[model samples]
Target: MTSTPTRSSDTTSSEYDSDDTNQSVHSDDTSSEDIEEVDEVVDNVAQGDPIWECQMCGALMWYQERKDNSRHSTVPKFQLCCGGGKVKLPLLEQPPQLLQDLLFGNQSPATKNFQTNIRTYNAMFSFTSPGMKMDTKINNGKGPPTLRMQGQTCHRVGSLLPLPGDSPKYAQLYIFDTDNEISNRMNSVRTNKDIDEEIVKKLKLMLDQNNVHAKVFRMAMDMLNDVNFQDVKVKLIADRKTDGRIYNKPTVSEVAALVLGDIDSASHRDIIMQGQSGNLQRIDEFHASYLSFQYPLIFPYGEDGYRPSILLRFVDDTDITKKKKLTIMHWLSFRLQRRKGEALTLLCSRKLLQQFSCDGYTMMEAERLNWLRRNQSKLRVGKYRQIAETPTTNNQSGPTLKGKRVVLPSTFVGSKRYMDQLYFDGMAISNDRPDIVARVFKIKFDELMKDLTKRHILGKVLAYMYTIEFQKRGLPHAHILVFLHPTSKYPTPADIDKIISAEIPDPKIHNELYNLVRSHMIHGVIP
Candidate 1:
């Protein structure tokens, strides 16, 4: 059997090659060292073959293997990565004209520099690829090839140039086209029973009325719909300064006024009165604190604010004659100083800090266990008598009730609610098991046992045992031990070599298996 070549063969000859070869031959009269240097230069030039990039997949190919060989071909087409002109994809919409002109069209030094160093800019903004090394001589050339994953793998996008008559793709597709957006939303909601036709209609109306991007889309559409490009350009130039002057920028006070909304109003006065009388609710205090409402931006589901009692206590303690109220600045200063000292003191003792963390963890675990015990009746396995009495098709010959006590699941490590419960529904993984991972593992182990014992994957199996273990990273792995029949056991080196080989499989022959092994089985040195 012959193996297929990994890359295309370069068969095209050029005038450049002929000219270089002739020059090298004529220069042979020079010194031997000079002739050798000339030969090396010729070899280097020959190795520098012309490469063509695919217009569809951005994959590099030999110029000789290009689908289009026309003299005027600006964009080369290829057949290997994407089927020859078969794959039709929507194009990414061009950036706004102003942005395009600023970035690419302008002849300014900044623009020229940006265009020249675009790759550098991209590398600066994007993630860096890691460097890795592998020992190729580990187990000789016949052993498994040492491999190291040096970087993250990502999809290579094709050229951004829009195809003729192709619709906008990606974010632009959803942003600008209302009908397309609505249709997409409808398709997404088709399977959801809660969102009916009426709800969808209401949603469409809401999007039409309140969608913030609608104005931007309308402006873009207006630009596209202009009958005379010159007139639109003139109008834009004329209104540029006027538009800038007309746009009112809100001040800090104005923004505060908008958020607070008429402090002298009856509702505001009532809240103020409640606060003054020490009768304000926690919700009122929360709304009063600007920091607490905006805390979600920094920490999701987080709140930051002082309780009414704390504020009152601060005011009472600070006032010498109980006459003056503590100002916001004073309260903030006090809190900041208090927190700084506390943090510093905590940092001073490592053991004490560790003890605190351990105590907190212990408290949390205790609370979780208490909650589970209190809610045991809510779990499916709580009704152990009913489950024991229930007849099972597989257990017809065995006693229905083996024990009275409900056994807890071994898989529960208090990670999530689904994993913590003894039994979620009528179906129990064990007598009272939980967690999808545990269930999946059990099913897979059963399948393996069936293959070994019943299917006779390795002749007749005398005995077999397996243990599932979790690595330090919490990922589960299995170790299996099989005792095969005497006839099936590998007695010779040849038989052992046939059964077990430590090497990467040929990708061309076993593509799926090769990919699986490369992705999951390959291990590299930890940084």
Candidate 2:
């Protein structure tokens, strides 16, 4: 066994027990290596001019302190937090600052302060912070009140707007684009000290009674999406300057002013829905996204013989088809029936429905619904089914019921030679709606395949057994489908409006409303 030689006696390997000798032998070799390593480190340190550098740990300590004050400085002591022991790691003073600012990111007194502030700001944007939290000013867990702005626009950048002579809208302007998602929850404070209290009042009302999501919130999100386009457009227009907020931008508080600070002049609603007297001839469904600008201009509900909060369905354009009239008739029929029984109606952008009026049909009072009730029994299922086993669209017709041998149509939409649609109000069936026991569509079946996994409207796939097509006169109309979720995320019409966006859909309460509206509409129009 190996043994360390002691001053008292030359080491002897003969006197250890077997186990003790085994341990002792290993320690002797290790201790010798440790001593050699320490000597080598000391030698390397002696080579530097003033101080020795320990290359292993990259330690630069003063050998001069050891040489000059051999008694005290050479043995500078360091304390262990625990009570067991103390240590001496040698003195290593960092160099004094010369141009510290440039090296330490403290180029100026201002820059030094900026760095500190940046650390604070970064805590919010970055996930690196451990205990960092977004202040109540920026992100209060309780969301802010939704503002209902009458005047706002919802158009994206580079999107085309309807114009004459087709030169294209050369200048993209964002003056009208913005959302009231600008919240009281923002970290920025505004002038209204009682804003929070006011919001609380509304929220309480909503919590206590309102059984639906806030419509205004949906509007705010739509506006926010539109804002991105405006932000990009305005930057280019200003070429990035004070005129553009993308430059040395204002604080969140200043943004509050830019958004909620000013209000526009209020005006007539007809101008909003249709257009100023001479502006409109017909509503162009394709260009309607820009119509957000006209929202405020839409007349208040009472202006056109409709009740308070009710606006004219259409403001301009006088072309109405017999089919459109009948469809509105059926809608009015359902609204009259259900609203009196329950407040059943749909919510959508007023711009889309501005020109939609039945005139005499729309002008009917709630009292008039009672008159229709006299013949309501005649509109019952058993009776109507027998009357309309057949359906007609332009020249296309479904097979007539041969004593209950009704040959269901193979599809709802097809090419001109084949379009077997069964929309309401064709010259066939004497312009009567038929009992639709079954329906199908030929093409664009993808629209009907529902996205089973999605939790949002955009996430859904088109669901169809077969696609149904609807046509107005001979022109294509937007497709109409229904969702009967065993557990739909949106259960009500208002719920649907809040959950979905620009793609507005009308959800009928029961099969009754569904079939009625279906009879009135022509699908296969929306691209």
List per-prediction Cα lDDT, in the order shown: 0.36, 0.26
Query: How many pairs of residues collide in each model?
Result: 0, 28
Best candidate according to TM-score = 1
RMSD of each: 30.9, 33.6
| lDDT (10s digit) by residue, model 2, range 1-527 | 33222222343221222333212222333454543443344444332222222222222233332223333221222111100111111111111122122124445654343233322221111101121121324323456422121221122222212244322111111111212122322122223332333333333233223211122222323443674532221110111112210122222222111223223432222112110112222211112111212221111110111112211122132223332221223323222211111111111212113222212232232224333445455434344565556555687667654553322222312323234443332335323322221121222233334333243344444352334535443332234455444565466788768656553245544666655555555344432
lDDT of 2 at 520: 59
TM-score of 2: 0.14
Best by lDDT: 1
* TM per candidate: 0.17, 0.14
